[model samples]
Target chain A: MSFDITAVVNIMGLAAVAVFAISGALDAARQKMDILGFMLIGTATGIGGGTLRDVLLGNVPVFWIREPVWILICLVASAVTYFIAPKLASRSRTLIWMDAVGLALFAVVGTEIALEFGTSSLIAICMGVMTATFGGIARDVLCGSNLTLMNEELYITTALAGSVVYLLLNSFNLPNSYDLIGGFLVAFILRALAIQFHLKLPNPHRKD
Target chain B: MSFDITAVVNIMGLAAVAVFAISGALDAARQKMDILGFMLIGTATGIGGGTLRDVLLGNVPVFWIREPVWILICLVASAVTYFIAPKLASRSRTLIWMDAVGLALFAVVGTEIALEFGTSSLIAICMGVMTATFGGIARDVLCGSNLTLMNEELYITTALAGSVVYLLLNSFNLPNSYDLIGGFLVAFILRALAIQFHLKLPNPHRKD
Candidate 1:
């Protein structure tokens, strides 16, 4: 049976935007930001990474400006998150899972886009990781929180691994569907494990 | 005598990039980051604002990617600043002035580019301010410093005023050179006065 891989990527991309928006709203709630701040930060988190990737790759008008459906997803997701965040007993847990899914989807989609743009594998891999992580970094920065990059957690490493996996699978001429799913699963499982086991990289500054 | 307005804008833009790179290197020094960190942050600060503006306006390949000279300027300025920062007795003073010059220049140049792109006046003005201010904001975020946006300072206000000035001059059919210079003077002088007088906008959170 033939399947449209592009269709699946687009759908998953929207899901990624929604989850990122929810994560951003949760961050805004942590900061006790106003409604306007919530919307702005949430939208930024949803679109920031993809926008940066498209721009660097010279894709004009950026993704949100072209389709705008991406922006609508961000707004709706953020507003819903704002209302439900207070009622959730385990907000942090929800945030972690949401972020992991977003990271995995964005990493694979971004790498695919860069490859389609005819960029080198190295650049494509880097763009994938950037697309996965930069949105959260922008959210933390706007919230004036400590940078997630400065943390010793295996956060960026997971994205990097996923991008590499996707590139490897593509090189092996695997079905595009399998490559996408394999990349996403590797990233999500790795990140979930990191969160579950509190896995961290070695910090030179930390005395053992 | 007919003057090439584009040439002048291009040259001054380089100057602006140089000053911004210096400021970023100084910030890296304050954080005691490694040499690689110095170069990375310096390049980001030097080109960050313009890159965002170009991407948003759909000016593909970005200014630096098309003309690698911009990146070269950033590297040289950053390395020079990294070396001289230790000997300066009042590094903060140098930083402030360098930042002011860069802001003024970037604001006018950015506004001109947006207008050339046929954007609405309001959008052009916003892009101008974004081009002037986003680099410093990114620098502060990367350094994990208290966001300058959180301060009640007139920093963003000055860039706004400069953008407005450029737009007003263009509307009045002034010479292109005069419009650029007029905007720069207004922004720089206003910022200088604010610095000298400790002028600040009223804070809503502050009790008299």
Candidate 2:
């Protein structure tokens, strides 16, 4: 079955934006932050990765500036999450899966954008990894957790795999639909497996 | 007294590196992070701004890569701060002042580097401001503080003033000594005054 690559990307981008925004809001709520703090984290988590991606690619006006819809989406998402957090707290596991999905989608889309901008495959993969992780990094910082760089989770590894798959598919001149589907499936499945199995990279100096 | 701009800049650059590295180490200790985290934050805070400036100017290898001394300085500073953090924490005010001095020094050094790289005057000022504040942004993120973008302190403003002074002096064909001393003094004094006077820009969007 044929898939619409552009449609898939656009939907994925929007979904990723919403999931990250919600995650940011959840963090702010947990921290007992004010409304402004909630809004800031939400907007940052929603757009930080894309903004960094655009800046590094020398894309003028940035993504959110070109389309105000991104900010509006974040604002709405933050507000909804802020108000409904009590009920949503029970579904933390669901949000974690959604976040994994968003991470996979963003990894593929970010790599594609970098490739379109004529970056080398290696640089494209780095950009994809940055795009998938930067928002969470920003969120963790705002939340006062040094875990952004210290967390031994398999988060960035998933992004690396997805980006590598995209590059390999493009190298063989594979159909764009197949590349997107395969890349997304690989990242999502890998991330889910990692979480379900409590997979983590070993810290060389981890103290018992 | 005639100032030697080159000598002054070199001195300030070293001081900036030391203070930034120290602050980074202190932050790592505050978070109870491991030694690697201390080193990462120290190196990042020491070179984050300048590295970004070089990248924006299309300069290869970056400044720190070109001069290994800066890396050594950062490493030593981090190690020293890590060992002395307990005593230093008792004197937080002094550390804050030292950090302010580093901020001023970095602003001037960054401005000069931008000019040397042939960037436009405006871009030079932007780069200088970035040099002064980007380290703090990186530090704040690593320390898990949301204050990076929201802090209304006179941080960037001080850098801007220093850069403008440097550019104006250079445009007047003043000796390099005059440019360096005048620029550094202006930024340093202004920042000190701002802190002493509790000066801040008026928030335009005060809640009614």
Candidate 3:
């Protein structure tokens, strides 16, 4: 039975966009932002990473501007979150898990795109990390919430590990499906463990 | 004597890139970030807005990626700022003025690019404002500093007004030089006045 890995990847990409938008909306609700603010942040968080990646890789018009379905997904997700967030007992928890899923998906997808664009593995890995993390970073910055980059959590590291694993699988001539699934699992599992156990990277030591 | 308007725009763009990089470095100095952090923030501040504009307008490879001189300029400017920022009597004041210059130049340049790309006047103006403001916003967010969007300052308004002025001048069929110079002056003067007088936009009133 031959399955279409491309279709699976596209669906996961949409899922990532939706979850990220939901996380952004939940954040906006917590920040007491207005409806427009919720939609703006949600859309930004959904597309910021991919937009950056596409720009850097010379992919014109960006994915969202060309398809716009991604934007509609974000808007709908944000509106839903805005209405449902108040009833949720653990909005923060939900946001984090949603972010984890988005991170995993973006890392793999971004790496794949970069590799296809003929970038070196290092640049591809970096692009993956950027794609995974930049949207959340933009969301936090826009909302004046806690910055993921400022935190000691294994956030970026998870994306980096996932991208590296994906590249390694590709090097082994694995099926595209195996590469995508392996990459996503590595990133998601690492992020989940980090959240569950409060695992963190070593903090920098600075002397004034 | 007639001048090369395109050359003038290019030169001004480079100047804006340098000033923004310096501002980013100053911000990093205040935050006590390391050298790499300074470079990262500086490069982002230098190119973030134009990158966003290019991506949205479907200008692939981005300006900086095409020329790379912009990145070189940012690195040099940031390094210089790192060495000299501490000796400055007032870093914040310097940062604001530098940002104002960048804002003015970028506002005009971005609008011109969008118009050339055949965008509507409204969309072009929005692109102008975004190109002028996004770099500084990225710098602020990365530094965990104050957000321009959250603040009541007339920052975005200055860009908007400048872009409108540019579009109006274009409609009059004036020389491109006049439009560019006129746009820059309006943005700079308005921002300068806002800074000098602490002018702000009306705050939104929200009731829980």
Instruction: Give the TM-score, chain B only, in order for the candidates.
Output: 0.91, 0.91, 0.90
Best by TM-score: 2
Ranking by lDDT: 3, 1, 2
The estimated TM-scores of all candidates read: 0.60, 0.63, 0.60
lDDT of model 2 at position A64:
89
Tell me what fraction of the real C-alpha contacts between chains A and B each candidate also makes: 0.33, 0.16, 0.20
| lDDT digits (tens) for residues A164-193 of candidate 2 | 898888888887777777888899999999
| Candidate 2 chain A weakest lDDT stretch, 10 residues | A199-208
RMSD of each: 6.8, 8.2, 7.2
RMSD of 1: 6.8
Query: For model 1, how does the per-residue alpha-carbon lDDT over B1-208 read when each residue is reduced to its tens digit?
Result: 9788789878878888888887777777776654444555787789889888988787876777566688779878887776677764276787678778888888888898999999999998999998998887778878787667546257888888899999999999977788888998999898899888888888788886
Q: How many residue pairs clash per model? A: 0, 5, 0
Of 1 and 3, the candidate ahead on lDDT is 3
Best-matching candidate per lDDT: 3
For candidate 2, give the lDDT of residue A139.
84
2 versus 3: better DockQ goes to: 3
The TM-score that candidate 3 achieves is: 0.60
**Mind giving the per-residue lDDT tens digits that candidate 1 earns over A74-168?**
99988888778787527667766877888888998889888888777766776797798788878887887765553524777788788999999
Against the true structure, candidate 1 has what lDDT? 0.81
